[model samples]
Target: MAANRIRVAKDKAELVKSLVASKDTTGPFQTYVEVMVFAAALGVKNKKRVPLGETTKREPSPIPQENFASLGYDLIIKLLGINETKDINILSSREEQDEDKRTQIFEEYANAGLEILQNELRGSVDYSERILLFLSLERDGYPSEKQEFDLRSFL
Candidate 1:
């Protein structure tokens, strides 16, 4: 069995946009983008910092949890390069698991997400909507073309 966790699902753009919307900041998208970039670097540095990148200049707020998750998933998928391989292993890094297992996990997660979107998150407010957006990574568990791109406008 695969591990189940609340992860992101939708396209990167949609998720980012949703996060921006949830944020109390009214500055601009660039601020959030910078913050997110620094946050990813912080994750790599293996330590926490109030400002992710100070040399860059203005010190923005710390990256939020969802931002980390988004960056992490992107790193995982890219590092794993599941696209080049026929499939992936949920435990590939640990025990050399196969792609089929990973693919199955992704499919199940995507399906579950679709169910949730239809039933629970179809018309939620901005805050609840952001939570649902982050949970979309699970819908995006495995790397592949987005199955929800066309729905972007609606989101």
Candidate 2:
């Protein structure tokens, strides 16, 4: 299973590299990878599962916990090129385990990808333009329900 996961990770890395190389930052492929990275990081930090339809006792924050269960942290780490043992250990350490801190660290990782995407799209386009394009594509074709949900929930 571990080996299979490694294979999958390698394949995903290749795909992401190609997407990055092609400079398709605002496209579905880049968005999917970014969302997966964020969702997975949330899963890693959130140990307990809050019951559905119940408001979490935790303070209000941006990233929704409800979506974390669908993505595994290990996979996210691989996709984001995070140094598994070093990065995960640092983030998960008891001394640094506060929810806010975890969220910050996760955001840093997630935002790095977003920054890359933005840089790729810079000069050529603006966020609103990309969003409009995405909206049009969503309207024209059957979008992946999970991707759409993640994109909406994250934003």
Candidate 3:
């Protein structure tokens, strides 16, 4: 089955060009609608594939772990891969909508590093203030670089 497959327009660059070059829509909905219409006119149904399951290697794979640690904000954001939005929303959800989720994310970040900021962080303060306060605490209190990074995990 794999041997019979004819690979056309390989890679994202070709895919994007193909999308742009073809615009055969009728209504106010422009690009995407036109694309769909073109496919429908040609009696082309969407291509289905066997599910990749737990081990599908998607394109544009993650950067090396060593590289991830160097990027700004990547350490915290990437490492915190997939948490529910409820837990990490001090800035967005100040209305007490989902403080528990935000708190849980905070605690998780704290745990990943050594700072363990759950106890020290004030509930009343906002995200920006917490960041500044955390930095100050890390610089003054923690004499080691590792400790500083740990506290910064939250910031």
Candidate with maximal TM-score: 2
TM-score for each candidate, following the candidate numbering: 0.25, 0.32, 0.20
The global Cα lDDT (0 to 1) of model 1 is: 0.36
**Deviation (Å) of 11 in candidate 3:** 39
Expressed as tens digits, the lDDT of each residue in 1-155 for candidate 3 is 11111111112212212333335312222232232223222221112112112221232221232332343322333223234343434334344334333333322332222112223333623433554576587568856666444666678
- For candidate 1, report its TM-score: 0.25
Lowest summed lDDT over 10 consecutive residues: which window, candidate 2? 1-10
Report the Cα lDDT for candidate 3: 0.30
Supply every candidate's count of residue pairs whose N, Cα or C atoms clash at under 3 angstroms: 10, 0, 4
Q: After superposition, how far is residue 125 of candidate 2 from its true place, in Å?
A: 6.3
Candidate 2 per-residue lDDT, tens place, 53-148, comes to 221222222334333434444434333333433454444435534333444434444444433433444554445465456447646975667763
| Tens digit of per-residue lDDT, candidate 1, span 27-124 | 22343543244223323332222221111112223223344355555343223335334444444645534433433333333333333333433355
Q: Residue 21 error for model 3, in Å?
A: 36
Clash list (residue pairs), candidate 2: none
From the highest lDDT down, the ranking of the candidates is: 2, 1, 3
